[model samples]
Target: MSDLGNTFMRRFVQFINTADEKLGEELIAPNAEFYVPFQSEPLVGPRGWLKAVEVMRGGFPDVQWTLEELVVEGEKIAARYTMRGTHEGTFFGVPATGKKIAIQTMNFYAMANGKIVGERGQPDLLGLMQQIGAVPAPS
Candidate 1:
């Protein structure tokens, strides 16, 4: 992993945890594409990406993501992470339950000119729902 890639990864994690859309705007390219497994269409550009973050934060005001592992190679980075939050607002049609949830996630990113140009994330939605009592756990 090049130093630049490593630095980007670290900065990305910090920016996400901070929930600062302004700072996030600077880290992404104008035409960046962000993909989430459950979304029908990829989010376009920094504005679109920030909107998604805002929605997530609206539901989990104190949400935090912990980067467990990151590997970068030739401008492509892969990360494994866990997101923790308290269910304080509506999310995906599920109302607040005042429960704390932690879900695992994996993401891949493409970078160029020190900005993120592409991203794809797979998150544990079922696990998250179960933790928040939106879905029942198996007996």
Candidate 2:
């Protein structure tokens, strides 16, 4: 992998763990597309991605992501990870419960010209909330 690719990967990881949205646009390409079926809203471009992330943080403060797997081939990277957080703040209408939560996620990113152009992720949002007692599981 090129140096730019490595840097991009590292920065992406940092952004995720820290929830530093300002660091996003610098690493993501303009017009980047983002998708996560479980997310209630659409996120497109760096700014939109940041906004969505903020919403998550607002709902689940202290959210953190750990990179368990990172594989890169050419211009594409796939990452499998888990997220940790505490529901100490209002999240999805749930009152601050100060409950800790963890969830698994898998994401793929396509790099173009050394910047992320596309990203798709599968996040177990509802399952996480249920695990943390923030929601009731279906029968």
> Which window of ten consecutive residues has the lowest lDDT sum in model 2?
1-10
Evaluate all candidate structures by whole-model CA lDDT and list the values in order.
0.85, 0.79
lDDT of 2 by residue, 13-130 (tens): 7986676767886788779888867466557788867776787788776887877778889989988878888887777777888778888888898988878898888888788779
List candidate 2 stretches off by more than 4 Å. 2-7, 38-42, 136-139
Find the 10 residues in a row with the least total lDDT in model 1: 1-10
Q: Candidate 1 residues 1-139, lDDT tens each?
A: 5677767777888878886677787798989999976578999887777777777788898988888888888889999999999999999998998999899999999988888999999989899989989889999
Collision count for each candidate, in order: 0, 0
lDDT of 1 at 89: 96
- Stretches off by above 4 angstroms in model 1 are none
